[model samples]
Target: MTTEEQTAVHAAMVAAGADRRPGGRTRTFHALLEGWGVEVAGVEEGYAWCGPEFDNDISCRSTLADVWPLLPPRVRSARQPRLDELDERFRAATIEWPGRGDEEQWWMWRIPRLLVIEPGDPYEGGWPAGWTMMPFPKPDSVRVIT
Candidate 1:
C-alpha cells in the first residue's frame, strides 16, 4: 500500500482508537500484533499458525481466511487484549454489533457474512446504501458518502 493510503487507514484506526501513534509512521496489521506482544516477526510460515477453525465456519469463507496472516493475531483470535495491551475495541461485527430478529444474520456488505457499517438503528432498515469514494464525508451518517 502507498504511504498515503496507509496514513489514511491509520488515521481512521487512530480515530477509532485502534491505533494511537498514528502520524507519519507506517501502519500494518503486524504493528498491532507487536503491541500485543505476539512474536509475529519472521512468521514466514503463512497461515500455518492460523490452525483449523481459522475460517471453517460457513459464515466465514476460506478466501477470507487467505488474509488471516496479514491481520494481527489478536484480530485473528478475535478477542479483547489484556489491560496492559493495546486499547482496541473489536466486535464479531455480528455478536457485538446491534441488530434484531431470531436471525443470526447481520448485513454489512459481504454476501455470506453481512457485518457492515450501516447508518441509524439496524431495526430501522439501514442497509448497503450506495456510495462512492470521495475526499470527505457529509454530516449525516446516511447522506455522508465515503
Candidate 2:
C-alpha cells in the first residue's frame, strides 16, 4: 500500500480508539463501533478485525469511508463504481471492503449473511439479494498500531 493509505489506516485505528492497551483497545474499538450503530456479530480475522453482521445491521459505512481518500488514485477510481453497483442492489447496505490488492485491480467485497438470508459466492455467482458489499483496507495492507 502507499504511504498515504497506510497513514489513513493508522488514523482509522486511532479514530476507532484502537490506540489503547490490548484489552482496552478491543473494548474501546467495539465501543466506537457501537457508537456508530455497528452490530457486532463477532470479532474475526479480517481487514478490520471486527466482522459486521450485515450491511445495514451496521452503520459503519462512514467509518470505512474514512479510508477512501487515502487509497492510491487508480484504486479509488476503480472501486467507486463497484461500490455504487452493489449499493444499487441493496439500499443503505454497509460496505465491507476487504482491501486493495498488490496488482492493479481491486477485489474482495463482503457483507455478513445472516441466517435470514441465503449465502452464495461473493463474486462470479453473485451475492444474495438484499446484501451489499462495501470497502475496507486489507489486514496485511495496513499497519494498524494495536
User: Pick by TM-score: which candidate is best?
Assistant: 2
TM-scores of the models, in the order given:
0.21, 0.29
For 1-146, candidate 1 gives per-residue lDDT tens digits of 45664555455455544443338564444444444232211111111211122123221222222334344444445533431232121122112222233343321111111323333522223322322221233213222111
**Total backbone clashes of candidate 1, pairs 3 or more residues apart or in separate chains:** 5
lDDT by residue (tens digit), candidate 2, 1-146: 56676565566557654445446544332343343332332211212323334333334444435544544565557657755554443322223344423322221244332223223323223322222232332323222221
Q: What lDDT score belongs to each candidate, Candidate 1 first?
A: 0.30, 0.38
| Cα misplacement distance, residue 79 of candidate 1 (Å) | 17
Candidate 1 wrong stretches, greater than 4 Å: 21-29, 34-146
Shift of residue 94 alpha carbon in model 1, Å: 21
Off by over 4 Å in 2: 12-56, 69-75, 92-146
